[model samples]
Target: MIDSGESAVSDSILFVTHSPQRSGAESVMLDLAAECHRRGMSVSVACPVGPLSESFPPWAVHVEIPHLGRDHGRRTRAGAAWGMARSMVVAARTLRAHRGTAIVANSAHTLPALRLAGVRSVAWLVHDHLVSRKTRVFIGAGRPLLHHVVAVSPTTASALDGLVDHVAVGRLGVDIPDDAPTGALPTGPLRAGTLSVLTPWKGVDVFLEAVARLDDATAVVAGEAFPGDVGYAAQLRERAGHPDLAGRVTFPGRVRAADALAQWTVHVSASIAPEAGPLTAMEAMAAGVPVVATDHGNPRNLLADRRGVLVPPGDPVALADAMSSIAADPHGTAAMVRRAYAHVAEHHDRRETVPALLDLLLGTTSSSAPAAPADAVAAPSRGGGGSR
Candidate 1:
């Protein structure tokens, strides 16, 4: 429990994010903010003016910090740094205004600003793999300023091994819809789809190629592109018009995950780069939608134990085969769906993860709280059925 003397400040939490886009990390913070508001905590989000700002709960405060990292137009390295510096100025001022409120830096991009603010109660919630040397160096430089560091998955925690210490694994969770079709497979022709920002690294093209191999199955690539990736998005749109995939693939722009998943017979995560913990795949698992993800990063662990299927990254043939197998083996697929639902319910329920995160933000802990164990941060069990 929080100390009585610090209750006043501890009850207020300010979340600082780098992107205005409602991606996985932003969605997590939004959900957390809503939960905090429901619990009568003072919640404020400091981010740039964009789609994310419009989604905050009515009671929560929205502090608009212009040009905060992600949305800044293309610029030189020095220019980007200068923009971040300006954003940090505003961020520091916001921190000073809030005074003792606990702070959650929702992205590594916010770390430098948090360091500049020099607040004591700060938690850096890391969501990326930090594979780039530049990103690793950037995050490592401000690590000492963080009071607590939380990673969304063990793979993510492992990536930060030497860069930061005492890293806690905080797996992303989703609300299992009351109508989630557990143990029930979708009927009719196969409809494989993926829900993520249409970036090259996400391997949306690979998913399209896999869907092309299917004779009559349709596909939905449901997301918009980031500003910097507009060219890639255009390329994807053009590819969708190619001979093989012409009318089979549909780009529905941006969509709610549930809306998209409801239409998908199978959900795919075909990222060329290793994902930390993709919320879309987790949501699919929780909703009893069979997942076929690349056998690397968090997905390898996520889909392990026959809970879902795993395919090699960028392998269209393997991905296509996995989708076809789901339709061919309905009984097996349903069983996998059931196991996935059970796994998500037991391990990734937001009821458990949110409070655990809240405890970190509130500077409180209890025996039952989901704190990291001594040897390593806790992750979902990886042993069970063999990989398909």
Candidate 2:
């Protein structure tokens, strides 16, 4: 990462997000982008074309183009490449429009084009671990392009194998109010909350299986179905209605991130697959809600002090037991909330993370320096090509 701490102010920033909707990655992008905009730096977010493109704030600029890669099988390989090319053209044009602007590219997927465009002063923000071949390809491709890399946690940074320029383990923050009212809890039984998109990888089925293990717990499932995965959501709904666990589970569709947090006593993150870092968990913690999450990937690092229970992945019995334990102990639940807040205040506060992230954008703070004495390229790394 190039050390640009020498500079005073960043003129503008182009944040590359893969989605316009509210995913974990997009949540970080929006929060930071809004903050930068608040700080009087011109900030804009560019995302692949989608229905949610209209949701960006009116003051900030928005650009949409074909996805760098297709989601699932929406486009062929050549089509994805072409889409990427189109997105690159838009990105380059956007960068040129706001000359001297910093490009904060989110996700490893955009690395290749950021590289091809030769846009100097780029920060690669790693929102999660890349465990798949396609994801690794993107990471390996973009490792060189980064002036710095921002990871959401130390655990996340450690998992990256030192490929990033500067490894800042900045956690995402939530602006939960201290005086906000905790809404009335359901009178029926022990209510559990889940806030994630309905995708197979997110393990909603696994969550349902856990619900099956609970006789009195009612699980409130939030978030929309992923592209081409509505059927899976239906299956979860149907499964929850089975005689075994029918009255114990319900799907209420998507909830506004803030409003959703206000409605739940506990947050559940049941991802069976590797999650880079989930904003859902962070938000839940910030809202002072105890989370019952899987003990893999980033959650283990975030939820340390028994603030929340950590269960092995793909284990419903464990999840059920943990939920029951939490529901049974109100005092323990309050303690969990306090501990979670303290953890966020001590380590994951956005106040600390955002400025460090800005350092990456300004080229002031980075782990790796620029590659050559050139304007565009940064130093090469072990398993990658030019600077992303």
Q: Best-fitting candidate, measured by TM-score?
A: 1
Q: Would you give me the overall lDDT of model 2?
A: 0.67
lDDT of 2 by residue, 1-388 (tens): 2324444456677787655455777767777787688778787777765645666788778765446555455457776666666765665554455435677888676666666566555677767754456667676766655666766655556556545445654555555455532322334567778888898888888888887887767778888886768788889888888898867776778777677766666788999976666778877777777788999877876777676789999888898888887767877677777777776655555655565555555556544232211111123223332232
Model 2: lDDT of residue 329: 80
Q: After superposition, how far is residue 122 of candidate 1 from its true place, in Å?
A: 1.2
TM-score of 1: 0.89
Q: Candidate 1, residues 1-388: lDDT per residue as tens digits?
A: 1222453335677888877777888888887788678777888998887888887778879987655564346367887767667877787776667546777888877766666776655677878875476566457656655567777888877776656646667777788765546566677899999998988999998998898899888999999998888999999889889999888888889888888887788999999988887888889988778999998888877887898999989999999999999989988999999888877776777877777766655556645555442212554333221111
| Cα deviation of 343, candidate 2, in Å | 2.4
Model 1 Cα displacement at 332 (Å)?
1.3
